[model samples]
Target: MSRSTPNTAPDGSSLPVVHVAAGVLIDMQEKVLLARRSADSHQGGLWEFPGGKLEPGEQNRDALCRELEEELGIQVRRARPLIRVTHRYPDRAVILHTWLVTSWEGDPRGREGQPLSWMPVAELPHWPMPAADIPILRALDLPDTYLITPPGFKETALFLRQLQQALDKGISLLQFRLFGLPASGHEVLARQACRLCEEYGARMLLNGPLKLARAVGAHGVHLDRRSLMALNDRNGYEGLLLGASCHDALELEQAQAVGVDFAVLSPVLPTLSHPDAEILGWEGFSQLSQGISIPVYALGGMAPDLLEQSWKQGGQGIAGIRGLWPSSV
Candidate 1:
C-alpha cells in the first residue's frame, strides 16, 4: 500500500519543491504583461507572467530582478508583493512569490525569444493559464480595500450620505454591515444601498442570511463566523458571490473548501473595536494566507497607508469598518 504524505509521494519519496518569483508588469492602460511559455517546457502554449526560480540562498526580490533582466531586458524599478501561492502537481510542488511591478527601466523585450502580450485583466480569463496561476488572477480582479458600512444606519439619510462619500473616495468593494435592523427596515435600506453602489460601479455584499442578499439584489453575501460554521449541506450554496469572516486557519480552510469568492481575516493588528483581542500580526497573517486559495483581506486596524503592507503580507487587500469609513461619517 502506498501512503502519500503532505509533501511526499506515494512511494515514500519527498516531492521536489520549486521556489519561483514571478512579476506582473502593469502598463498605464491597466494591462498586465504576459509571455508565452516555450513549447518544449511544462504548461507549454499557456501564457504566463515572467520570472524564474530562486537560487540557493537567494532572496525573492533578487531572483525577480535578475530574471527580468535576463529574460525581458528590463530592471524592475518599483515592485510590490501581490500574492504567494503553493501548488502541487503529480510530480512536484511549487511556491510562487508573485509581485506587481509598476515601474521598470528598459522596454520589456522578450530576450528569450518568447512572445509577450499586454493583456487586459478581464480578457486574461479567456486565455488558457496554468492552474497555479489562477490564484494570481483572483487577486488581480479583487480591489485593494473593502468597506463595511458604519454602525449607525438607523439614521437612514446620514448612513446613505456617508456611504456615498466613501464610494466617491474610491471604495470599489463594500459590505452593508449594519446589524439589528428589522426585516422591513433591512429591505428598504438595502435597496437604497444597492442603488448607491451601482451608481459608483461598486459591488456590495449583505452580511449573512443569503435570502436577504437575494431579496435586496446585492452582489454577494458575507457570512459571519457563526453562519459559516453552521453550513452543513453544500447543495444550496451556489448562484451568488459569497464571502466569509475567518478568525483562524481552520475557518479559513473551510472558507476555501466551501467555495467562497473571498474572505476577511480579522485582528491582524490591534484596534479600538477589539482592544484586548489577540492580534495576528504580519507573520501570523502571512502564515494563514499562504495556505488559502481564495482572496483573503486583512481586517483589524487597516487603513489606506497599510494597503501595500497588506499586499506584501499575502493578502488580497484590507477590509474594515472604522478603517475604511470616512471620519466625517
Candidate 2:
C-alpha cells in the first residue's frame, strides 16, 4: 500500500489531509482512464481515478510520471495538469491531482489487480466514484448560465406580487432555493414559483432536493458543492438540467469534465456572511475561466450592473445572493 501522509490545504488547515498526485491518462476524444479499487483497500470495491502520492520536492509533471507507472504500469511522455480535487472521507482525505494527459507510451494495464474501464467523457457518471469527483463529472457535461430561482423578490405574498410585476420587466431565468419551509408548504410554493417562471418562459433549478425537483417538475437541478460531490449518475436524472457551484479552478475543471451545463464561481467579492474568506478578484477569475470551454458566472457580491464588466473580463454572467434577488428589474 502507498504510505499515507498529511497534506495541508491552501488555507494551512490540516483537517482534510490529501496525498497529492496526478492522474494523466486521457485521449483526443476526452475519454479518461478509470480504475476500480481492489476490495482490500480503503473505500474498496469502489471506482477511483489512478494516481498516488507526490514525493517531496517533485513537481507535478515528475510526480505524475512516477505515479502512473507505479499504479497503472504505463509510461507517460507528456501530461497536462488540469484539475485538483480534495476529497474528505470518514477516516482520511485524498487530494486528487488530475491532468489532461493526451500522450503516453504503452497500453495501460491494471497491474494493481483492479478492473479497468475506458469511460467516454459524456458517460463518466455511470461508475460509482468518490463524492468529491462529482463536480468534475458535471462540469464535463454542462455549459454556462443556468437559471437561478426567484428571479425577483422572493415569494412572500407581497414579494410574489412584486416578482410578478418584475417578470415582464425581464428576469428570464431563476432557481427556487427556498429553505426552512415545510415539505407540504414547499410543494405548494415550488409549484407557484414554477408557474411564475414558466409564464415568463424562464428556467428553474431546484436547490438541494433532486426528488423535490422531480416532484415539482423543475427544468433542472442546482447542486451545491456537496450534492455535486455526492452524485454518481447525473445522467440517471434525465431531462433535468445539472448545474453546480464552484469556488476554485479545480472545481471548475471537474465541473467541465463531468459535463454540467453551467457552473457558478462564487465569492468573487468578500461578503459579510463569510468575511474571513478571501475573495478571488477578477484576475483570479480570469485565470480560472481561461481555456475553459464552459461559461462561468461571477458569483458572490455580484450585481446585474456587473454583468457587462464580468463579460468583458471573460465571465459568462453574474450570480449573487442579494444582488440578484431584489424586486427591481
Candidate 3:
C-alpha cells in the first residue's frame, strides 16, 4: 500500500500516465458499490468505486471484468462505458476508464480485506473521494440532454406550459436563459419556473446574475462568456452547481480553473442563428477536451439524435435551445 499524492507532472512538466479500468457497480436495489482503500494505499482512507488498474495488453472491458472479480468477488456480465477521466497528482497520473456495471453475478464483498458499503447515488457527494472520482460523480448527477430556453418567451403561462411539457418528456436538466425579459419579469418567471421544475423533479439553472439566481432559488447559474472570464475564483458559489459557456480551449481552461461543475462548448456544428461563426467540428472538440476532467456538453445546432455523437466526441451530452424545445406546447 502507498499513499496517494497530488499528481504532479514528473520533472515539473509531464507525468507518466497509467491507464486504469474502474466500474460503478450498481445492484438491483439501485445502490452503488463503494470500497474504502487501505490506510497505506494510494488515495488511502477514501471511498472509491470498486475496480482496479488495467493489466498490460488487456482491453479496458476485459480488465474491468478481471479486476472486479479479483477485488470484489463479483463477475461482471453487463457494463457500458460511463466516462473517461484523465487526472494528474503530485506523484502520478492516471487515465480512469470508468464503466457502469449494469449486471453482475454474485453479491459484492471486499475480498481484499477492505470495507465495503452500498450507497445511493444522491449521497455520493457527501463522502470523501479522490480527485479523479469527482467528475464521475458529477456525470452521474447530470442527464444526457441539456436544454436551454429560447430568448424571448415573454408570456409566463406559455413558458411554464412548454417547460412542463419538456419536463414531462424527461428533460431533467435545463437552463433558463431569458435575456430579453426585464429584471422584474425575469425574476417572476424564474420563480415560477423553479416551482414548476420542483414539481417534475428537474434541476433548473438561471443564466443571469448570481444574486438573481439566489433570489429565485435556482439550482445554479450558467455564466456567459463575459461573466466566466471575469471570475477569479469559485469561493462564493460553493455548494451550488456552476456552469459556463466556452468557445475554445482557453475558455474551457478558465472554466475548469474557476471550479465550474460543467461547461457547454458551442459551435460544434454550424447553427441557424450564427451560421458564420467558426465551428469546432468533432475532431477539434475532442482535441480540446483531452485531459480535461470536467464534463462538457456540445451545443449549437444540436438535437436529441446527436446525443451519442456528443458522447463519442468526449462530451457529456448535448445542449440546445431550438433543437431541444418544441415550437409550441
Candidate 4:
C-alpha cells in the first residue's frame, strides 16, 4: 500500500493487461511459503508467492488450484480471495489475483527446479519480494474487522466503559475519532484510550493531527483526505501505521505516494446518519480496487455480516462506527 504509479506505457498508451493468479500457502506453524524466481526469468532472484499466468477465460480460483498442483504438488483443500494487485511496468501491466490457501494436502516443494523457502509472517516484509507481491504481505497482516470510535461522547467516563467493552469483545484495531473536541480534551481522552488498548493488545489510531497523534502515544495516525494530501516526507512517521480516508483513484494514488499503510473506502452503502450521501454500491466499491496496491476497508453502513461480501469485492475488511461499534459495546 506504499508506492504505485499510473498503469500506462512510455508512449502514454494503454498496455495489454496480463492476468496471473497467486497463492499464499502457510505451513502448520503458520509460516508463509515463497518461491524464488529463476535467475534468468523476470524479476529474477526475488522471492514471490507461488503462481503463474492464467490462460484466457480461466477463473482465478481454478488457476490457483491448477498452478499449486503443478508447481507445488499440493491439492488445495480450502482457499479464499486475498487481494488483487494491478501493477504496470514499462513493457506490460499485470493484474495479480492472490488467494489465501488455508488448507492443503501434500508437502510444498519447488517442482520447477527453483528454490523454495518458508518464513514467519512478520519476516515477509524483510524479504526481497517484487513490488506487486508486497501488498500480499500487508493483506496477510490485517484483521477482518476495523472499529471507528463514536463521534461524540456525552460523558467521558461512559465512553471509556464502552471502549473497554469493545476491546474485550476482541476488536483489535480502532480509530479514535471525535469531532468538536478541543486539543486538551483530545489529549486526555487519547491517554486513557491508549492504556486500555495496551491492556487488551489492541491498536488505536488517532484521527487528528500527526503531532498530537505522536504526542498522545497512539499506535498510528488515520488521516482524512486533506491531511493525507498535506503529507510529503514519510521520515517523521517511521514505525507508526499510517492510514488514510480515500474516495477515488486519485486519492488512492496520493495515499500510496505518501507511504500510507492502508485506506478506508467509505459509503459502500447508504447510511441513516448521512441520508443524502452518495453510495458506492458494491460494483462501484469493486472498481476502487482496480489500480491500487493497498489493503482497503469498506467503511459506511458496514457490519459483521457483510465481511464476506466485502472480501469477495476485493476489500481488506469492513470498518464502521454505528453498525460495528454498538454491537461490540
C-alpha RMSD values across all candidates: 4.2, 10.8, 3.8, 3.7
**lDDT (Cα, tens digit) per residue for candidate 1, span 206-238:** 885778788888988889999887776444557
Ranked candidates, highest lDDT first: 4, 3, 1, 2
lDDT of 2 at 320: 65
Error of 2 at 187 (Å): 1.7
> Using Cα atoms with residue i matched to residue i, what is each candidate's TM-score against the true structure?
0.91, 0.53, 0.89, 0.91
lDDT value, candidate 3, whole model = 0.85
lDDT of candidate model 4 versus the reference: 0.85
lDDT of 4 by residue, 1-329 (tens): 21124466323568866678899997779899999998898789999999998876678888999999999999999988888887777667777889888899999988888799999998999999988787788889878798999899778888898988888789999999998888798799998998899899899999987788889899999999998877885778888988899887788888878878899987899998889988888888888855578889998899899999998898988999998775332
Off by over 4 Å in 2: 1-155, 327-329
By summed lDDT, the worst window of 10 consecutive residues in model 1 runs over: 1-10
**In candidate 3, where is summed lDDT lowest over 10 consecutive residues?**
1-10
lDDT of 2 by residue, 83-170 (tens): 4555666666666655556788888888877788888876778888867666456434432333354433344686566556656657
Clashing pairs in 3: 6-89, 6-90, 7-88, 7-89, 7-90, 8-89, 8-90
Candidate 4 or 3, higher TM-score: 4
Clashes of 3: 7
List the lowest-lDDT window of 10 residues for candidate 2: 142-151
